[model samples]
Target: MSVPAWLARGVFRVQEAAMRRPTFAMLAELERTQWLSRSEMLDYQTGHLNVLLQLALAHSPWHADRLQAAGLADAVRAGAVLPSDLPRLPTMDKRDARDNVERLVWRGVPGGVFPYTTGGSSGEPLIFYFGRARQAADAAGRLRARRWWGVNPGEREVYLWGAPVELNKTDRIKSLRDRLVNQLLLNAFEMSPVRMDDYLQAIRTWNPRAIYGYASSLALLAAHAEARGIRPRLDALRVVSSTGEPLFPHQRELIERVFGVPVSVEYGARDAGLMALQAPDGSLLQMSETHLVEVLDAAGNPAEEGEAVITSLVSAAQPFIRYRTGDVVRRSGRADPGGRGLAVLDAVVGRQTDFIVAADGRIMHALAVIYVLRAIPGVGQFKLIQHAVDRLEVQVVPDARWNDAAREAILHGLRARLGATLVVDLNLLDTIAPEASGKHRYVVSHVPLHGALAQAVA
Candidate 1:
């Protein structure tokens, strides 16, 4: 190992030793539970679910009233809450989370509360709270998934994702900490051809064991690499994991062919935490230890094809009890091929948000603009149209929450992303129609990507 690698490992060991016992124990426990039988796994999930529900009742009056109203309170009080019996509770949507955030938070939670905002895929910004367990659930579950791909924690890995452009002092410190963990963060938002080449070279030098990025962004990079006849020979590379957007079949083929590594899919949301990961055996296994995934039809009936109603077992600090995720998923009839006993899903059916371009020629993930609009309260539903590098049109469907200040906030946000000179026109709409595909994407970029190479060279 290099000197820096040795130093990173040393720092990691010290940090691990300083971690709370409960947090460390949880990570250790997942290693064993992943191999349990299906029935045993279900029981294990229910055990955590029951504990979360009790915590919700004790801390969050909003969830407490719902459980009592739905007649699920008695069963929970009697300690008879079963994994199979969760559907008796009412389902929650983003609106409930947005409006009742305070009521839903368990402030006195162990390790305290953490506030976070979702970069909305459905154009609905939701601010939610989480605690230590939720954070550990995401990180440790991902570590377990990496092990499935023959990679371990502290192993060299590359993150191809959007980064905060303006980093404060705290952000810089976090970046240093990230480097100490043997991880590199590449800017996924700006992927001009020249930068892609630089990124490929960086990968060759770093020799990351695994590559993780947005599905579309990785595919775009692979396409660019193929176009330029650049096939990087990274011997240490093991897996290429795609996330934040659905992995289209063609995109998957392109990525696999270019990277010379197996491609895996990760399905998760900031609010929901890590839900599922594509196992090495090709099964999309729900992280059943941390979440309870339910596919419910429009009528709230259990169905093979429907929206994913998630009950996050780790989200006790802000219990997302039977929350409707607005994500389309089809439950798989196939069993776990790896026989790890985790729940399986056939596919995640969702449209990939298009990449956006800034006035300064930064190619950002669609979530960058989505993050701006969704974080604003008066924005009931929004659609961002990037007409040019320096111009944007935002179509917002305001509910009863509409206000004039939202317009200025929207303009300020657009300028921040596209540039100060960018023209932003906000149009208030009563409704925004879905595409011919019947899916409503929060962001659409009409600005062509043909000039990416030229922009990069400039």
Candidate 2:
């Protein structure tokens, strides 16, 4: 190996060991746990769940009240609370997390707490606190999942993602860090044809072991590449990891055909942390190491297809015990077809956000508009439908917090991100109905990206 390549890997190893905030310890542990018996894995998870429960009871007022109300507080304190007994706790929604951030946060966490907000893809934005251990778990879980496909840490890979605008500074530093890790990033927010061509060339030159990106963006890139006959001969690319949205069968086929690699679907929300990743055997296995996911029907019964309620085991800084994720998922009690000990999820039927074309010719993820509405407090539920490149229709169901200032805030927010030339129409509604499929999408764009995506972000 080249000296620098070896040096970077060595440095990362030292950092992993020395770093208390987020070490690679969990990644090492995952190697053996994946093959453990299902009962054994549950036992392991139950151990962590008990600790989290005790911590939440002592530190978090929100969880303490709920646990007490459920009459499980004393049991939890007496160390008799089992993981199976978790569902007894009442479920919390986005608003609960938002309104109770202070009460939920364990401000005295050792590594301190990291405050952040969701981009509002789930119809509302929430400010939550996550500690370093939670951060470490997410990173390590991903690394272990990558190893399932023979891709190791620091291997050459490409990230086609766009963080929220406020994370620009962090993104810049991350870009530099990515380079050190032999990773390249191609912005998904600005996917002009010219930029995509550059990305294709970069991917070919980089010869990455895998490609990771949004399902739709990758599919669109594949479509554009196929249309223009710009397929790069990537000999080392082993897999295409798709996240941020659902991977439709057709999109998967197109991506596989163009990239000549299997598409692995990763399902989770930022608020909940990394929940599950697709296994090599094609099973969507929940990260049983740090997450306890429950699938419940509308009436709150355990069903085949229903809302995904997640209890993040690592949510000690701010417990999300029995949190209603508002995502539709089907889970299998049957062992993972992959023969892994991780629990299997039949599917994560979550929000299908569209690609919005900005008036200035930028192609943005629906989360961009979701950011506008979610950031406004008075806006309860909203949908932004883009009918044309220059027009956006916003349907908002105002809440008690709604005021005249909120209306102006929405307009200003949209104008700032989408550009001034775009015409935005606001409509107040009592409720926003889901589609025939019974899926509620906060944002949908009818305008095609055929030529619109040809213009990269300026």
Candidate 3:
């Protein structure tokens, strides 16, 4: 259905305000209360599951049918269902969720639904619905993290992101509005060596209190500055937060060393909002009050630490129950130690789409290669591509700092991780190309579908 232009503009304005106002404050309070409450963690999980189930039955046809099919219509009558009952429900894949967007979307309510699109990093573009209330709650969670670095809304902020843009004549007005809002917009697609130099100068001149952007882009800037022996004074900035991709330990260390600020890391997906954030003590804490997180094993049962499955508690417009996030995270410890209840994300591996299978049925993630190759002294940029089940290719762009020892270290690391039986080939290249989304994938598998083999691959 076509929406009126004025209505669309009004929706955008409402969403922007909700993302930056009193709603965020309420969300922070709710998160604190939930963590401090004396209730058992299992009871909290069941309560949230029932809430989401009720919302699904009321609004989302996709979820309604799935629940009915599993004979769960009465199970959610009074929020008394057991945790063991959740496994009886069917699993929903990304394609299934995307195909039924209309059934999942609610319309004509002030804070009912918001349309969003994915970054298409996996070569799959999708549009989904999110409730404004949940979106506001998510905004609040982000603001709570920002508080760790002394950032406040309405203060001057700079955003460096990778969203698609139209550089038309209309950009003049948009630029003016951005400046009026005390915000600066930098495109991620235009990051070259020269462009990065200009960005550094802009930061030094504007001197915003906080800087937020993709971790990879910022790491590139730090590397360039280190190589050129140019250190710009950024004393005005209190914090630096990196999102949109996994922030490597080496990158975080380098950024902190160069900028002289604490580096905060966060994780999120476009379909949902912020999932987890690094606390002051360096633990990645899940937003338990606003969302429910599950770490499932290969058998689709709850694992002590495995793949992350999310069930958004506040999204009434489109319920995301037991939705696989394609991310691998391990549970930090037993749930609800003491009265403080929060799921701790111990570690995050690469995407489920980027796993490589070995002949012995072991699965290896892309970060394994990154952890090894990044330790090599002279490696500037690297990419690993898997052409078959047991064959892999490694491409590296070397800097002047690399020597024979660096190459040997990389080779040895690969052999150790993939086992000496697998074929490991290294190719020296001037540059490594990024994916279509302007992000790099550390691993790519081209093998056709095979059930058990696929499980082994992941």
Per-prediction count of colliding residue pairs? 1, 1, 0
Candidate 3 wrongly placed segments (more than 4 Å): 1-22, 28-35, 38-48, 82-84, 108-112, 119-121, 165-173, 334-340, 352-458
Q: Judge candidate 1 at residue 417 and give its lDDT.
A: 70
Of 1 and 2, the candidate ranking higher by TM-score: 1
* Residue-level lDDT tens digits of model 1 in 292-361: 8999888999999999999998898899989988889999887787878788999999756788887766
How accurate locally is residue 419 in candidate 1, as Cα lDDT from 0 to 100? 83
Q: lDDT values of the candidates?
A: 0.81, 0.81, 0.66
Q: Tell me how far the alpha carbon of residue 192 in candidate 1 is from the true structure, in angstroms, after superposition.
A: 2.0
- Comparing candidate 1 with candidate 3, which one achieves the higher TM-score? 1
Q: Note the residue pairs that clash in candidate 1.
A: 189-363
* Per-residue alpha-carbon lDDT of candidate 3 for residues 1-458, written as tens digits (9 for 90 to 100): 12333453344456477554346456557556546543566576678778778767776788888888988888776665665676677666555666777887666434556776552233233567776667677777876767656765545565765443422334677765555555566654444456767778777776776777777666666666666677779766877788766777777887888788877878888776678877666777777776677788778888877767777776677777777776677777744433356667876764423545555544433444555665565775667787876787878777777799988887787777666776777898887776775544656767543442232222
> Candidate 2, residue 202: CA error in Å?
1.7
The candidate scoring highest on TM-score is 1
TM-score of each model, in listed order: 0.92, 0.91, 0.69
